[model samples]
Target: MLRTGEQYRDSIRDGRRVWINGERVQDITKHPMFKPMIDVRARIYDMAHDDATRDVMSYEENGERFSVGLKLPYTKDDWHAKRRATDTVLEDIGGVVTRVGDETAGEMWSLYDGQDILNEVDPRFSTNIRNHIHHVIKTDPFHVSANTDPKGDRSKRPQDQDPDMLLHVVKETDAGIIVRGAKYETAAAYANQAFTKPTIANWGNEAMSDYAVGFVCDFSSPNLRFIARTGFAGRAPARDYPLSNKFDEVETLVVYDNVLIPWENVLFYQHTKAATFIRATLHRYSAFAFVQRNLKLADMLIGAALWNVRQTGLEHQPAVQEKLATLACYREGINAHLTAAIADAEESPGGLLMPNQSLLMTGRVLACSQLHHMMHIARELCGGQICITPDVASFEDPEAGPWLDKFYTLNENWASEDRRKLLAYARDLLNSDYAGHRLTFQLFAQSPPFAHLAAVYRNFDWNEALRFTHKSAGLSDQVWGDKR
Candidate 1:
């Protein structure tokens, strides 16, 4: 079920409810801002067919070949290998920042969805679970997992809010259930074929039964509409802003107006405990996907920073050399965590490989650290050029051309215009709203920093290390609590 970019585009072009300002988008593909993002995502599909990336984008299984996506590996080694493959694919594409399709979101979603149903299988439902996996692999449909409910107030329960504020089963028919409500900030929803679950909502004891449901449906199924995101970043001109042209991030409000799902697609309904259990477990595995995403972005930043060092003719300066070293350290730290987690994966009950939780958690904790430091290093090494550089268009102006050429000139090692182009790219990243938006999302999307640290403190076993230290200090290991 390999989809070309255009094929993916045409699938979602059926007049979804997309509005910016006051007008609804008639055609998402031709929309000025949305088109660039679609094109970038198309390139990701094209990479699968590319000679350079084909090896990384696909893998061999049982004498047959399959696309290596967010695939569920049969063993721990295969799991790490998949991560390596994801990194390689992302590198060839220059990074994972702007595009919608990077294999992380969909691959993991399918894996978790399959595992959830398998966990509670009676013979009949178990067979249904297996069939869904086969269907996904054969069709290779695009999927986005919707977990966040657009809560009216963070403190209130789903029942406390207006019932319509939450997405819940409104009616159960012999055929399937009908769902109404919305999920917001659904990344890749515009191009996805379906949405998967554990629904993230406060289903108080009373609301639990109706809310604790998981299922699948076609993206183009009746009564669904996408309210596309709008702003300077989303609406920037394509020709004038080449980087923004493809791979724009789209946030959509997925409105489910009485959508129906057949009996087979319903994984959990009326089992509130099962829903919570599935949510906790999936959150654990999603750490692997996050590592894949962060590593890809860090690699891109490293390339940009190194190029900036040379472009500014400061590559040899002591200060610049030190900044590059710090940048390299960030890259090495993230890769090291990912490597260690892979090296220690354990097989789970549901026939899937799970990352070592402590190592994976450590990886999550350090994730933002690496990114923050990369931004700091970029500022130190790149200089004001990232913020003050002239636009690519300035060269076209007769009055500005002579001054642009004269002042923008670099040393004999590189042409001034060439240097300017690279700096301009960095400038767009650092000086524009893109940088701030990234920071906001990074903090906003994550749990509180202290909550993460507390999990690390509680979940990791430090007894072995503590015993070793006490013995090294010439004290008996007995000073410590039971080795058990």
Candidate 2:
């Protein structure tokens, strides 16, 4: 049930069409732009087999070992094991990389919780979702998510303009359903499959439509193309941009031109109720992993800022200490939410244990909404040296090397080379092109800011607050009316 790194690499070499920088990538496993991320994913798979990590990364069921990330949750211990596995991977990799697998797999679990709604339309649709969840555990393939479509116009209906703007069921055949459209997905180029679905939340009074479709898209199928954004690995030396070179997860615009989805792969079809249920509870479990990434990012900010002050001997300043405390508060705020969510875990409608929804949703808002300001605080603490420092080439130059060394060296313990490396790291983490892209990616990746608030509104106990206020005000029983 578990795959090796080489086996995982070989599985994606199925001759799928992928384009980046105006060139067709023949081997994604060997290409410079994609190879770094592929290697990271491969390393994660290898960790499951390693003697030291096998216990933490995998679980035994019926004499077979399976990935802990893909296992269906049943108890609180299961969630703790999953969290440890993800944290171990992040520590092993030495940086944050979302969309690897565990973070996106839970999206399918959300749909699995809606089986009753799915059964309302057809029992087969519910059966398909259950089969796919087990299939993922049995096969251990790399999976991702597909939701956002390149909806061309907001004012015009899909029928009035280009119908293909939003992904719809173009034709249903005896063999399968052929779909034509595109979706902006991260890691889809290298991932094996995606849980494809719609982003529309409101269905009004309509009960069925072509856009209300969801399926498991096999990336190796024909008529599929992956157009990726240019990567940051080969563009510069790894010494100058450490994080960018090793951790940039390239995003792709995956185009589906008359692609076929067999009946077995279809999770739901022509049912707006299923689509509505999915969008409402999409991130219920996945948000735990997504917000966990922000926690790691917060650590990066704190590490860079604290080290900068230590090098300059400013750690003794009260003002500097206050800023460091602020960063700690942000980090612990996320920690509290994640910890309490698990402690107060609730059972899903499908009988699976999920993190407390209210805490998880509110945690997502706290982590994402305050990220920009946290980055700014860290940037200020690092000073202007991060942006004004010269490149590695300038430091190694014969004429400029001596002058740069004389100016950059602070003490015998802090040499010019180490100083240069630190500034370069700080710059890449907060000021470079990669930094900006990562910030925007986190801002809108899971959904938009407004959606985060809406999730919190729906999950929070508003009735509890109303009941307390009514009792404190000594309101009459008649005033309660049917509100209770």
In TM-score terms, which candidate is top?
2
RMSD of each: 3.7, 0.9
Q: Write the per-residue lDDT of candidate 2 for residues 1-484, one digit (tens) a residue.
A: 9999999999999999999999999999999989999999999999999999999999998899999999898888998998899899999999999999898999999999999999999898899999999999999999999989998997777778898888999999998899988898999999999999997888789899899999999999999999999998888888999999999999999999999999899999989999999999999999999999999999999999999999999998999999999999999999999999999999999999999999999999999999999999999899999999989999999999999999999999999999998899999999999999999999999999999999999999998888899899998888878877
Q: Candidate 1 clashing pairs?
A: 36-245
Candidate 1: list runs displaced more than 4 Å. Answer: 50-52, 60-65, 97-129, 198-207, 231-242, 444-459, 462-484
| Strongest candidate by lDDT | 2
Task: Name the TM-score of candidate 2.
Answer: 0.99
Displacement of residue 85 (Cα, Å) in model 2 is 0.8
Q: Give the TM-score of candidate 1.
A: 0.85
lDDT for every model? 0.63, 0.93
Give lDDT: candidate 2, residue 178.
Answer: 91
Which stretches in model 2 have alpha-carbon errors above 4 Å? none
List the lowest-lDDT window of 10 residues for candidate 2: 154-163
Task: Show pairs that collide, candidate 2.
Answer: none
